[model samples]
Target chain A: MTEFLQQLLNGLSLGAIYALIALGYTMVYGVLRFINFAHSDVFMVGAFIGYYLGHHVPESTVWGGLLVLTAAMIGCALLGMLIERLVYRPLRSAPTLNVLITAIGVSLLLEYTGQLVFGAAPRTFPPIFPSANFHLGPLTISSNQLLVISVTLILLFALRFIVMRTKIGTAMRAVSLNPRAASLVGINNDFVISFTFALGSAMAAAGGILYALNYPSIDPLMGVMPGLKAFVAAILGGIGNIPGAALGGLLLGTVETFVGGSEWSTYKDAIAFAILIVILLFRPAGLLGKFTVEKV
Target chain B: MDWPLTQMLTVKNLEVCYGAISALGDVSFSIAAGRIVTLIGANGAGKTTALRTISGLLRAKSGHINFNGEDLTRLPPHQIVARGICHVPEGRMIFSNLSVDENLAMGAYLQRDKARIAQNRDYVFSIFPRLKERLTQAAGTLSGGEQQMLAIGRALMGDPKLLMLDEPSLGIAPKLISTIFEKIVEINRNHGLTILLVEQNARLALEISHEAYVLETGRVVLHGPSPELRTNPELKAAYLGG
Candidate 1:
């Protein structure tokens, strides 16, 4: 029972990170109807931002850790907005296939640029927050794990408040639903699109910081695997559904952790892909996604 | 026949094209303040194109669109809406996922005063009490006629000086059409709001409008008082179903 509980805790922490990253993918898809393949690289940039910010602040302090996280989020938010304004805005009326290819091109550009700038060697991530291990019976819980879960909960609630209660947030939904109707009702669609990119990128930044807290290894290519997995989670939960992404992340994390603890640990990564395949074959609309017929 | 009425909107030799094909060519018309001016035509007759151009959704190739002495030719859709021209687009494009109340709030996106928003909401509720009852319901779940009501109510929330409706009766039940038209007449009569209506239903549109323009292909082939156009032999044969 304790063994099961330990794996559950570990899975949840990892899943929380995936959930944060998945939100960015899902939100961008919701507003623009196109997958931002470069979103994962934004996660990598976020971690690097935190790593640079961490050196300037005092380590092992709550305020210092929060400061690093916030600075990274704001930095990535600006980067995300810049990406949308410079790259995506020009192709606003272009075909979806063109946008998809551009996104892949962006991903390659970010990756190669990151390799040139940050170097290929992996660096140790500094301990931005105080760390401790707690034991309850035979099950162990780390402070880093607690931080990841608590921070994700707080961020999720903040997101809900913004989307449900605020005007700009409502406008985002309006734009997502029908861009033409949105403009007719006086919403500036461009502003809303930029805001969505910024918001999603900020969340991914938070995810990067939290993931680095657990893994302690920082590299330019690090986001590739986790980013792919988070994309799967977003699809599993239902792309464009906020709560769906979180649920998908948590479920994928738990299942992957359980598989890793077993004899099939070598195929842990394969497990995520397999689940994706199965989901695609069966529930293409995803668990929470409602199938809507296109209205003529 | 002549009243000292100021022209609220004027379009001179306006032309709109979609890529290589022209949607509206040399379309010219004017609307006086506190008048219901309608553009009646069949499908693909440039009625919707004209309304869309006036609302700034479509760019004009040539000529000017002046609304209350202000040139609206280069303005964006949101800016045109800010200038108090609200368009309830075709097919009652209400945000189906959002609650009816939220749809109304989006209509008042430019308005800042909280009390004024509340007053506008009250006015909408008074006009369509059905919308008030289903305020919390998702707009998509509403019946077709109810959706039409919500669309009109949503526009009214903007406090627009000129309300342009594209096919208010389209896709609605025959029984509900009369109710919606009665409300349209009531809104124009009570508030003296300038209205630009586009409709495929020629007979009903002519009965309600003060001035009418008949669009064929892309250009305005005829324009006169509603009563005069209703009696024209050519219009009757082509549109009023002989």
Candidate 2:
């Protein structure tokens, strides 16, 4: 039972990272109705930013860690907005396939670009927070795990507040419902789309930084696998639903962690794809997603 | 009433096209301040297209739309809204995911003064008490009539100088149609709002309108006062269904 509890904590901690990354997928999909495949590359850039920032700061305190995280989030937010403007803006009226292909192309561009800039060789992520292990009732929790969970909670709450309580957030939802109607009420949809990208990318940055803190490895291709899993998580939660994405991420993390600790450890990545398939078959709209008839 | 009153809005030789198919061609009309002007036509007669063009949703291929003495031919939809032109679009396009209050809040998207926004909210609630009762409900869950009311209410939240309502009577229950029409009259009378109402329900639209224009296949086939158009034998046979 204690072992099960231990695995649960590990799973939740892992899920927190996935949840942060999945939010970008779900939100961008909500507004644009297309999966931004390059989002994972944004995650990669975030980790790289954190690595460099941590190296320069060299003070592994919690406050220092938060400063690095904030910096990474801001950087990724601008990067995300830039990507939306330079790449997706021109293709706003184009067919969905063109955009999807462009996204994959952007992903490759980021990866190759990162490889050229930072080199293809893997670099160890410097510690951004001092490590500590706390044992409570036979369950041991690492400082990184606690940090990941707490930060995830803070972000999720902030996200909920923004999406539900703020005026711009209301405009965002209105745009997602009907862009023409949104513009009729004086919403600059281009600005809203850019803002959505910035918000989503910021969360992914936090995910990237937290993931590095726990795993301590960084590379150009590092985001590929985690990105795929997070996409799967978004789908599992219902692709366009914010809360659904978070729930799906947690569930996916738990299942993957349990599996990884067992003899079928090699099937960890495969498990995500498997769950995605099963979920698609059973509930194509996802666990929390309602099946909506396409409005003509 | 003067035949040619002071014009609040004017469209001159406006033409809109979807590639090769012209949706609106050489459409010219004008609305006086505080007058309810309506465009009555068949479904593909481009009535909605004219309203869409006026509200800046569709760009005019060649022509001019002047509103409140300013040219609005090339402005974006949001900019047009800023110029006090609010369109309560066809199909009652309310945000389904948002609450009734949130939908109204979105209607007042550009309004910065909180106090005035509250007054607008109060006005909306007074006009549609049912909306106030269901302030927390998602707009999609509203019945067709309620949705129509909410759409108008949302538009009113903008405090528009010129309100363009597209098919407000479409898909509404017969019992609620009269009530909605009454609300339309009350909105015009009390608020003194200039209206450009587009409708497929010619009889109801003509009955409530001060001036009426008949559109057929992207052209204005007839233009006259509502009572004159209402009594026309040819219009009665064709549109009013003799």
What Cα-based lDDT does every candidate model obtain?
A: 0.92, 0.93
Model 2 interface CAPRI class:
high
lDDT of 2 at B47: 94
Which regions of candidate 2 are displaced past 4 Å?
B1-5
Spell out the clash pairs found in candidate 1: none
lDDT (Cα, tens digit) per residue for candidate 2, span A1-296: 99899999999999999999999999999999999999999999999999999977856787888889999999999999999999999999999999999999999999999999999999999888989999998999999999999999999999999999999899889999899999999899999999999999999999999999888888999999889889999999999999999998999999999888888889877875787788789999999998988795
Q: RMSD to native for every prediction?
A: 2.1, 2.0
Candidate 1 Cα RMSD (Å)? 2.1
Chain B of model 2: TM-score? 0.97
State every prediction's TM-score relative to the real structure: 0.98, 0.98
**For candidate 1, what TM-score does chain B get against the true chain B?**
0.97
Q: Docking category for candidate 1?
A: high
